[model samples]
Target: MSALKESQHLKIPLKDIEIATNNFQHCIGIGGYGNVYKGELLIHGKSTIVAVKRLNEQFGQGLKEFLTEIQLLSGQNHPNLISLLGYCDEGKEKIIVYEYAANGSLDQYLRRGSNVPALTWMERLIICVDAARGLNHLHHEVGKHQTIIHRDIKSSNILIDNNWVAKISDLGLSKLGLSGLNRSAVISRVCGTPGYCEPEYFSTGIVTKESDVYSFGIVLFEVLCGKLCCTVDHDGFQLSATVVKDYYKKKKVSEIVDPILKEQMSSELIRDFSKIAYRCLHEDRDQRPPMTLVVKKLERLLAIQDVLLKAAESTLSDVIKPAHPLVREGGNASEIPLDISVLSNMRDFVKYNRLKQFALRALASTLDEDELWHLKDQFYAIDVDKNGAISLEEMRDAFAKDLPWKLKETRVLEILKAIDSNADGLVDFTDFVAATLNVYQLEGQDSERWQILSQAAFEKFDVDRDGYITPEDIRMHTGLKGSIDLLLKEADIDKDCKISLSDFCRLLGT
Candidate 1:
């Protein structure tokens, strides 16, 4: 685009596209710009599979966009961003060819009741991270001084390759910010998908990286909740982002999310994942974290889930079998050794169900302060991020205000046994940790009352199965006063001392 000589190299002969597409006999998809066809083209000397988009001027105002796409993609190249191999500007025929996505667009799989297998929680997290990284490159690292804004960011535009790596595609609406990436630039007109676009960018003609952040946020929720942001009702009325925002703010998102997802993931992972997505939708764009920060948080979350999964598959006996009465640092007292089953379940943590959480709290209380304090340092040292998640200070503030409501993993006691070589009760943090469990195992001795039980992750880790979760049960389950208060307040919403599944799911956002 900058030089005619350089641009001419990307020109593909019309005959090649015709040969690749079998004379335009099979159409894979239809779009605003034109019809998308799947085909194979021989480049240099070898044949390569590709997706071909042919320009249909009478179909939509794509002439300008098509030229813009060729201009922009002609200069950009990244793994996460789609690659534009070449273009065909032979007379009236205008077409672009790029690598084919075997898995198709992400939206096809995200829609509910679809025939495609649902993506696991881990897969969704990875896809989001990939998409975020691509956007980050576009917003910050594309050129020495240039910043590009992806004017149209949505679920459908994200393509998943055969390996399931997400790729950001369709940048026809993208803009090259004349100003640096650090600042927002004014645009002549507002354009983008309605529900995915930000209010500020839509109302004012000012566009920034934050605008893409907003749209990406909506996509994140769509991935998490497994539903589109803008859904048409029977009356053709579209439910905007505000409705989703209201659902999140009210903690009623659990009712709308895929119950299977909530049931499969831990409450801690769900809360933390949702928190990042929610911040991106903040009314004040400045409050939204930069793409780099979002990438860090999301990657961290994904890592935590991966670790938790590995540990869940391991047993306490599989690792080190420490003797009972494990003394605390600088304090020696003969006490009952922690239940091995409880320790085993701790490894699984959020990988299975929230039941792991109940077992965690129960172990804390069953073992006196002396025993619990022994693992405090190891617990806080799970990651170098101080709290391994949202800032510890920010996390404490959230729990303080939304107490008993957002008692996140900050208090969940992520355990890895940090096994010290000195035979002392201490953690080393990087000792090749690995463990797992069936999660559905027998409990402690009959009279022991504190054994870990293999139960539901989302709910019902009924250590004491009278079919009800009471104050005594709560106190014994999770020892922290904050968690006890949050769970009790949330569970016993009727104040009748009864825990309602509905009320608890609302608080968990699972």
Candidate 2:
């Protein structure tokens, strides 16, 4: 009987990752979820900056959750949801590439005070609305499938980009069900950030949409107060237990408002938010409003705020000619294209074009040329040690002997596996020759087998048409399975932030 096999996933090679990240030198942040590093990935010859979330090698959550999470996230598309690019599913090494958010986590602004001066109240209110909309999409806007519940909702889980748009991140501990009520309910080993967890779920094992509301309530309180939930009175009153508890009790709204806001906040807005917060913290799970209601209310609030702000701005400003040439009133930023001629001389481009043309011409030159087989031999002539064997070890030594860093043994093994057809331990001269010949002379065979599967996976994962897979895409496509990052790392042959056609073929292989 055949043993059950894990589904194959796309992987990013490690070498490409090294070049993009400058050897992981520009890591901007680290968290319980994972270490986040900065990198640039090339998609269709265009370089785009991305954030690389590297799951901790030793974290059990990292090992169990990387792939499942990526697949789920990849298939989902909503204005509220973060976009998943393509992904890399190498063997045993997992990494997720994402669109970099320059403004970083909401927690950073709230806790660090570094960018706090810039976060106006209007921006904060908008952030809350944006977050609620994303949650609403997960709960109701997604296609005819089960609803999703973000088990962990906290300030840190919300990310902001350069434009100050808020997005929910870290789907590692989420669950699937319509309002957390379904026959096919999903339950995991109890996991969630403390203080944000619902008391019922924390005490019992049952997870429900009410649990998510409880967490969202915590986030709402945090956003209003700019404070973290603490067990002890590190700041004052331990907001999680005191004000949060009081709000739950008799709607003691004023007690829970962040003391830091003293006189700066609007009383009416605070009162409105306080009422919503109380509703969110309802003791009876059934009484709590769904994400849909929450999102709708938040949108109405934002609309009112926008009208008021625009009217206020209109009164203070006088029209003047635009000072910044590139700052069009309603246009988006354009990409500054890199000229390829900068890297190649006229002679090189001509030589490259000529070789490609010659290759194409050779394909139709002769239908039955023994020259195809001979050319295969020329490709494998690197086995000059005369061992009649092209061991992966031999290949690695040949290629990396002059390089500065240690070449990974696993990568060489993957390359060997690609060339070795019979699951053989070694790649003999014949095997290498056959592999080379297949690439050049096997055009006669129908290309549909590889092309169709490849295109499907690419289209499924490449949401941005950037021609590169990202962790977000992997999660969306795989139905929100966790451990996607780990799977990508294992499948990545070269440690690059991409899974090429060659890598895709390996995953598709039986």
Considering every candidate listed, which one attains the maximal lDDT? 1
All models: lDDT? 0.64, 0.58
Tell me the TM-score of each prediction against the true structure.
Answer: 0.64, 0.56
Which candidate gets the maximum TM-score versus the true structure? 1
**Model 2, 331-389: lDDT tens per residue?**
21112111111111111222222212222222223324443433333324335455666
Please list the Cα RMSD from the true structure of every candidate, rounded to 1 decimal place: 16.1, 26.1
lDDT of 2 at 222: 75
Candidate 2 lDDT at 119 equals 59
Worst 10 residues of 2 by lDDT: 337-346
Stretches off by above 4 angstroms in model 2 are 1-10, 112-115, 178-188, 231-235, 245-252, 255-264, 311-510
What is the Cα-based lDDT of residue 499 in candidate 2? 59
